[model samples]
Target: MGRDAPAAPRMAAPAAAHAAPAVGDADRRRARDIHVAIVGGGGTGAAILHDLTQRGLRCTLFERGELTSGTTGRHHGQLHSGARYAVGDTDIARECMEEVTILRRIAAESIEMNYGLFIALDDDDVDYTAAFERACSESGIPNRRLSTTDALRHEPGMNPNARHAVMVPDGTIDAYRLPLQFLATARAGGATIRTFCEVTGIDSSDGRVSGLTVRDYRSGRDERIAADVVINAAGPWAGSVAALAGVGLPITPAPGTMVAVKGRLCNMVVSHLHPPGDGDIIVPQRNLSIVGSTQWKVDDPDAIRTPPDDILRLLDRARELVPAFAGAEFHAAWTAVRPLSGRTDAGGRELSRNFQVIAHASDGAAGLFSVTGGKATVLRAMGEAVADDVCRFTSLAIAGRTADTPLLAHREFFRRQERVHEPV
Candidate 1:
């Protein structure tokens, strides 16, 4: 699991913004030697492709739907400053802090750096405020303590009765566009991207994953792809993907429902200063304020039914954070599945937010690895970690440069060039 993996650089690799390498010109001979197939087209898969291409590796990705169709797109889009996890999971918090800084430097275009505020609704929350600052400081997350007056002045939408609030470096991410920037960079660097492709079968020989049978969901065309490595970056569906290869992964799908209401109630991200709870976060996205979320385990990621009660409850909670939220126009509601590593004995909230990169070689399947869990805030860091494992398996000494790589601008993800998206 996460027990003994090599450490990757905490800083981002330098980005090649103006002069990204031409597509289809990557060393074909080298790519043929270590062909890798990454499944899923979410943030993780896109990041992996970016990492692999940065190392000049030959790789292809298959997404069952359009890119960011899963959790990546449905998320509340908080570009975490690691403040949320400081009290519960310091390691992940620290990673988020570093990755957020790196992302701001490399992919600044995809982030809305509006910052955040941790408000104390009452005296009990006041007590927790000290703990929050302490935890954030311990995790190296920068924050500023604010008096009740300053807090209310900064965000008039906050509860008038609130006691204290702290400022943190939280921001909003363009969930749909950020990942595409990575995929676009990969495409520019000679990687293949296949959308609407679902893995129908995992074909292995000699106790190792050798190929995959993928069906184009949009066209119903079946295609076989041979690969030296297969990475499962399927997020909440990672367990399902692993099962096809006859591997058992203790992965639990945790679905969280978020509701978006019209109007940006606050310019800053507002979160409860207490323990993790449903409807505790209200993030401003574009012109709307999104309240997220309620978490519960699920048997199937695709089958999770959105609970209407959650939406109603969130509105009530949002009213606590912002009085205007009471009459805010309804926007949209959706559920996002989180890939939490299973500890059968623990509840969904009890599991660590830290990600796990599993090597299935011990589980009787070589050349197969599964990456599950973690937040979108650390997608590139997670990608680097996964690439470290891939490097070990392929005996490739490629260092990760994703942190510094300026991906194709988020707006240009779909702007196909002459050589981009060339067949691998």
Candidate 2:
């Protein structure tokens, strides 16, 4: 969708960190007339809340657990430059590059622009270099080819046997803080974020969504909330949410395992130079080096168990790229289920990484929508796309301003004294 969207801004100075702009009295009154409910409290939901509120819309978000308790909190935190998907899907690649530029500007405090390198570990990897670089350039992702010596200079910990390397605009994100910033700003704009509140039923009538039945864990009571529209942003659990509304979503909960080791083995993100696959990415977060992941589809997002063999395969792969990875002390091993876009017979590697906003109007649920797939890097874009669709569905002309609006710091989310998990 980003390929057809308007051109993105060029890289520029980061936006000055600021609180959310105040909403006008008239705008607030108008927004209150049409309340929208969002399911899930992950990054996509957070961004959706922020975007809708910024566009002068009344919004409330529901999360069964603490915010970011799902897939959002468990990611390896690589702020992709689109290079990983460049060779296969240039559109998604360009979209990532666009979001990277925007996030650097609006959410600068939550990012680390340490960059990334794709190193060739074998002759086959070296053979893929020319095509990879060309694809990146064609997709508007900046890249640089480097010899083994040059690559080692950037990452002294890398394997000395690396045949060559390529540099891209990859970076690291504070997986928790980035989404919290969106929530913080959304709160400042009058969004109601309810955590530990589970949506048990979708209230619909005459092929239209009317409201929701929710269980408030904090108060041990069930309550109903009226809404004009409902957006399912439940990530890997989107299918289950859609089933509650008597609709179907083609989401695959593809789980991947990641292993974290003690010490920062590399300052920059490192990956294999070949195609995207299992155990390819090694991201440096704070003082830990994280190597991920192995992909396979599962029916239940909640039932995922990190395989012991995945840890071994990841460390072995990490060692191939960074020789020191083998000796690094093991820290943790976990799995994060990806909300991949489609159902597949094979491992989800064949599924496109791009997200989709599916309006359930055709399924006899006029006011229901589900936003699924996509990576953390394009959360803002995912929000914008869904918000735009919501506006069109409601015949509202409000435009999204999230791309230009700077978010409140993640710390601000906690500084506010107001309670978020009140009864209903």
Candidate 3:
């Protein structure tokens, strides 16, 4: 989360409403006064709102708590180059590469292009490293193999037993800054944002979404906000939002936990280059290191919390990679649920990392859409696809120009940076 603020007054009123004359009208007169209600305020939701507002559509972002008080705020802060997914999910890898390139150029102040190291700590994995390099290269992710001596020279803190290493174009990001940047630009474009507002229900009429019922957690007052379309960008709680609409969505919550060590144990993001498993990546953040994560399916997203055992497991694995990390002081820990879609028949781990944009027509519902199951790195592209779908459904003539537009001014990013930390 960026910084906390005192509560503000609610929006003056729901913007003017536009109704569809018929179900299949070709020139379905667009909602001139388009008020889009987004269900989350994390990176994905914020990006969606920014995309909508950039296209000249009005938006109201509803957050249950502070902005980025979700997965976006708790991530390991690695701005991927898709190298992590290159071996298994090439599609997601390509998308990540494209998005990371775009984000680095547009949100320069929010990102630290520190690059990343994928190391093989044992001789048994050196062959795997060769294959990994080939796969990353073929997937268009820049990957270069490094000799053991050269690798150790760059990362003396790395395991002395490391047999091989590959440098990929990954980087650390200020997860908090990126979403706030998106929210700030969205607000500048006339979008209204409400925090501590929990969406209670979705009001529909004649099989089409009409409005939303929201309750203020602090004030204990409920209000109905009219909208032409409702987008479920609720992160791990996306399924819950769909349930409020009486729609059954199959989103499984996969809980992952991260622990913050008191100091930077490594200057670069370090990965074991193994398949998705327990704490295999260590990311360096400001004044500390974020080591994560353990992935397991969970029944509830909201009930997630870091367990003592999880921290112990992470510390054990972290020490195996960097000996100094064995005694690193613990700062804090956090857990977030990643929305995973698929079934037991097809292992969830084997499920595609690509996002699914499900329009309601297939589910016998209208005016409701869900964008689910994608990593934070590619939120921009996912946002573009979602905004385009919304415009198509509402017949809004506004052009989708978010990809070309920078989300924040350089001056604004630096100004906020000065306020958040002591200047060097």
Candidate 4:
């Protein structure tokens, strides 16, 4: 999940199209004639590539290392149902709910509809139940209240002293596979993907983006690629990417530590009944049960380390949710940096989890856009928002259909022989 992960393996044959007919020669020609270069190969970039290519725009994606090697690969893998953020941010909660429905339709293979439980362990947690359930309902998230006996029966492993509980449509997400599905669908639409290619410079003219100068890590060679637009979707590193274009972006790389224990102590995603906080959520990924996370601001996303204290603290918190968590063998621990939308001096808890697409025209870098913030749950919406902004900026009349379009299976990404650049 770090910057030094192994290079992505070579993919096989092109995936079969699930959205529309195979792109025609004329369509590809038109797409190639209006080039767009995306800087990042994570979920956001993958979705953007799919959207733009479907709208008949030629696009190329550049990644400094392997795809999903950064925050995307390290995600906690919780398929949020908007319940967690309902109390504080209704808009984000609703967005998560909306995207969950859409993603379940398109990327079904990458998800586990196992559902989740928010258990109240104490008087405070019990008192918060009413507000929590109300917020969820206002946000259109279905929540079913349960007695402690019923809750324990649903998840026998949870803390026996749990006073109350609520069920939400939360599930587990294959973070890596979901993005790969988007990338595979994009390839079928005739978009080019270049892994191990790092964007070194932004070529601009008359205060507008012109192209990109990239270093192909595989070949150890630098090459100049022309483009009409350049989008920075580098997640936690988006601020650095924008700096390359001489644009100042308000992005905070807030890192959180997560620890995974060996056994699947809980089958359903278990969360604290109170407001979102550190180590309050535990998600089951296959045989491993993961508890996370403690957040704090960091200047560099790459320089982060899993603090020893966070590990102990998270395990302690996990014990409160599921007492069995204390005895489960420790599996692994890691940190993931969140690309919070604002510059915060605190632990970034005050910042909204919502996303924003900033067109750098105001910063004298027209044709250059940067999208930051948002969680994996609403990645498609993030792409749709950014794509709409890019289209409006370029005065292109293109409508996004990613929501209604079905994506190819995740494994199909490796099965597709598409336009992947082979470094010479």
In candidate 2, how many Å is residue 85 off? 0.3
Spell out the clash pairs found in candidate 2: none
lDDT of 3 by residue, 247-298 (tens): 8887777778898888878887888966666888888888898888887777
Local accuracy of candidate 2 as per-residue lDDT tens digits, 1-424: 1222233232212232233335456554665688899999999999999888777778899999999999999998999999999998877899999999889877888887888999998989989999999999999998999999998899888788999999998999999999998998888667899999999999999999999999988889898999999999999999999999999899899899999999999999999999998899999999999999899888999967799999999999899888899789999999999999988888889889999999999998988999988999999999999999998898776678788877877887888637464332
Q: What is the C-alpha RMSD of each candidate to the true structure, in Å?
A: 5.3, 4.2, 8.3, 5.7
Clashing residue pairs, candidate 4?
Answer: 12-416, 13-415, 13-416, 13-417, 14-416, 14-417
Total clashes in model 2, counting residue pairs 3 or more apart in sequence or in different chains: 0
User: In candidate 1, what are the lDDT values of residues 1-424, reduced to their tens digit?
Assistant: 0121133332223354323334344443454478889999999999998888777678889888888998899998999888998998999999998888888767777888878899888878888888889999999888998887998888887877777788888999999888978877777777888888898778899899898989977667888889888999999999889998999988989899999988988988999989888999999989999999998887789967789999899889998988899888999999999999765555688788888899998887899989988999999998999988988787665567677666667655566564443445
Candidate with best TM-score: 2
- After superposition, candidate 3 runs with Cα above 4 Å error: 1-32, 345-347, 409-424
Model 4, residue 362: C-alpha shift (Å): 1.1
Better of 1 and 3 by TM-score: 1
**Best lDDT among the predictions, by candidate number:** 2
TM-score of 3: 0.87
Q: Evaluate model 1: give its TM-score.
A: 0.92
Task: Estimate the lDDT of model 2.
Answer: 0.88
Q: Rate the local accuracy (lDDT) of all candidates.
A: 0.83, 0.88, 0.77, 0.87
**Arranged by lDDT, best first:** 2, 4, 1, 3
TM-score, every prediction: 0.92, 0.93, 0.87, 0.93
Please give the distance, in angstroms, between residue 173's alpha carbon in candidate 3 and its true position after superposition: 1.5
TM-score, predicted candidate 2 vs. hidden true structure: 0.93
Candidate 4: regions farther than 4 A off:
1-32, 422-424
Alpha carbon lDDT of residue 50, candidate 3? 79
